[model samples]
Target: MIADAAKKLRENIQKVIVGKDEVINLTLVAVLCEGHLLLEDVPGIGKTTLARALAASLGATYRRIQFTPDLLPSDVTGLNWFNQKKQEFVYRPGPVMS
Candidate 1:
């Protein structure tokens, strides 16, 4: 059953992505294991497209965060801010929260 779902997702992603079964397989594995995927490669290699495709295949929301050397942890995970109206701190979810 899980394999069938993965196969469906792979096919959906393949519609937009070219020949990269290994990448798709790794993505499936990561999803199954509830892990993260880090695609470090040259630009214009379908990294962002693949991620967006998978998100769309799963009917999930998509958000992009440009990681940089100077990026803080709060930037990716968000931070609490004081809401003046409520007079309390509230968490603003970051891209990872998507």
Candidate 2:
């Protein structure tokens, strides 16, 4: 049953991503095991796309943070916005919070 669900998920992802079944299956294994994956691949090799595709397949919210020299911690955590009318700070959730 888990295998079937994974296969269906893969099929759903394949609609958007192409030519990477083996890698997709390997990534799906981690997902099935409820473990996070560390994909150490070069740029433009579909790593991000694969992650996004899988997230879409499972109806999960997807977010990508690009690590760069100038990246800041708050970028990932988001900032609190002040609502003048309410006179209180409202917390705007980030992608991670989503």
Candidate 3:
């Protein structure tokens, strides 16, 4: 059953990302293991495309964050701000929440 799902996901992602069977398989493994994947490579290598395709295949929301040395935790996890009109705090969700 899980294998079927993985195959389907791989096929669907392949419609958008080609010549990356190994990467896709590794990605499926990571997802099945509930682990994280770090894709580091040169530009225009379809890293982002593969990510988006995987998310789309799984019906998951995709959020892209430009990580930088100056990026803060709040930027990824979200932050709370006071809503002057409501006189209360409002939480704004960030990429990690997606």
* Clash number for each model: 0, 0, 0
Q: Can you write out model 1's per-residue Cα lDDT over 1-98, one digit (the tens) per residue? A: 99899889889999999998899889989998999889889989999999999999999999999979999999999999999999999999999898
lDDT of each: 0.92, 0.83, 0.94
Evaluate candidate 1 by giving its C-alpha RMSD to the native, one decimal. 1.7
TM-score of each: 0.84, 0.80, 0.94
Candidate 2 lDDT over 6-25, as tens digits, reads 87998988887799888888
lDDT tens string, model 3, 1-98? Answer: 99899899989998999898999999999999999999989999999999899888889999999999999999999999999999999999999999
Runs in model 2 deviating more than 4 A are none
lDDT agreement of model 2 with the native: 0.83
Q: Rank the candidates by TM-score, best first.
A: 3, 1, 2
Two-way lDDT contest, 1 vs 3, winner: 3
Candidate 2: give the clashing pairs.
Answer: none
Indicate the residue-level lDDT of 83 in model 2.
Answer: 100
Q: Pick the candidate with the highest TM-score.
A: 3
Query: Which prediction has more favorable lDDT, 2 or 3?
Result: 3
Cα-based RMSD of the predictions, in order?
A: 1.7, 1.9, 0.9
lDDT of 3: 0.94
